[model samples]
Target: MSELSVTTRSGPNGPVVEVAGELDHDTASEVRALLSGLELRPGTQLVVDLTALTFCDSSGITVLLAARNHVLAAQAGMALSGVPDRVQRVFRILGLDQVFVTYPTVEDAVAAWPQQTE
Candidate 1:
């Protein structure tokens, strides 16, 4: 299995977390911790870019849900971008596709992020 890596970058609306490689039970905690530590503002959006994700398991999905919950608890929005087709299918089967907003690319998600009202 490929080693999982989670990296964060500043986004137009907030922070972007890019996850690469295999996301399974072994590495889910790493991602969960990082997400839990983010400082988000009410109008900001947390973008999780999974473009380079090679694989994901149930634990990975749980971490994703946790990320969503973290953002919501902070009064921020969350989106998933560049989700692999395999994972997309699983999301659909689990009805998570309805729970999470998704974009075909990171750029698209950023463009669609709602602007903060002054």
Candidate 2:
């Protein structure tokens, strides 16, 4: 299993979390903790960039849902991008596709976020 790593950067809309490696039972909690520490503002869009994500299991899926719930509770938006075909398939089979907004790339996801007016 690949070692899980998460990198973050600021985007125009909000923070972009770049997740790489396997997000399994062991690493799901780490991801959850990282997400929990974020300071999300209302209307901001939190983009999870999965371009380098190697694998994800049920535990990872649960963490993803929890992240979504967190963002929603803060009145923010959330999106996932660069999902691997295998991971995307799992989401489709579980009908989570309907729950999460997905994009082809992080750029596309970030671009789609609602622009904030000063």
Which one is best on lDDT? 1
Worst 10 residues of 1 by lDDT: 109-118
- What ranges in model 2 sit over 4 Å off? 115-118
Q: Which 10 successive residues of model 2 have the least lDDT summed? A: 109-118
Off by over 4 Å in 1: 115-118
| Candidate 2 accuracy as lDDT | 0.89
Residue lDDT tens for model 1, 1-118: 4499888999999999999999998899899999999999898999999999999999999999999998988999999999999999999999999889999898999998784221
> What is the lDDT for 107 in model 1?
91
Q: What are the root-mean-square deviations of the candidates from the true structure over C-alphas?
A: 2.5, 2.9
TM-score of 1: 0.94
